[model samples]
Target: METIQFIHSGWAYIVLIVLVIATFNALIKFFGNKEFDAKDFRISLFTLITMHIQLLFGIILWFTKGYFDEMSVGEVMKNDAVRKLAVEHPATMLIAVALVTIGYSKHKKKLVSKPKFKVLAIFYTIALALVLYMIPWNQWF
Candidate 1:
């Protein structure tokens, strides 16, 4: 369980870095009217992959932790910190991951550079915000 937590924690950094890079890249390219090239595709794909991997690690960690086994749903909900760690974080992170997946899929369907970048920019930025909001900053740092 500790090993899983450690991996999840470490992988989160990569997920965050790639997500930021992908979001910023898309935003810059979209605003600048720059053509979407192979590099852009690669970066977006890499970001998606990293996020999915992090999600997998997080799920493993969550199960290993057996958070619900320690407390009832009411108890978990009543405690702010416990609620954040046990429920809010996972739920928000899942939503963020879903956003990334949807963004990547939508971008792939767009034929033009602007539309692709625009889709990526909007979705990734929102996803990044969610990720940033839900991260257990105090625990990680």
Candidate 2:
């Protein structure tokens, strides 16, 4: 359990770094009217892969922690810190992952450079925002 937590915590840095890079790359290209090429595709794909792996780690950590077994839903929700760690973090991260998945899929379907970048830019930015917002900054640092 400790190992899982450590890995999940460590992997979060990679996920955040890739997500930021991908989001910024898409936004910059979209605004600059740059062509979407193989490199761009690879970056976005890599970000997606990293995020999915993080999600898997998170799920495993959540189960291993036995949060639900430790407390009732009401009991967990009553405490701010517990609620944040047990519920809010997981739910928000899940949504962020879903956004990344959707963005990747949408970008793939678009044939034009501008549209592809636009899709990735919008979706990834939102997902990045959520990820940034929900991260347990104090704990991680």
What clash count goes with each model?
0, 0
What C-alpha lDDT, on a 0 to 100 scale, does residue 134 get in candidate 2? 99
Supply the global lDDT for candidate 2: 0.96
- Candidate 1 segments exceeding 4 Å error: none
Residues 45-91, model 2: lDDT tens digits: 99999999999999999999888897999999999999999999999
Q: Report each candidate's C-alpha RMSD, comma-separated, in the order given.
A: 0.6, 0.6
User: What is the C-alpha local distance difference test score of each model?
Assistant: 0.95, 0.96
Taking all chains together, each candidate's TM-score versus the true structure is: 0.98, 0.98
**How far off is model 2, as Cα RMSD?**
0.6
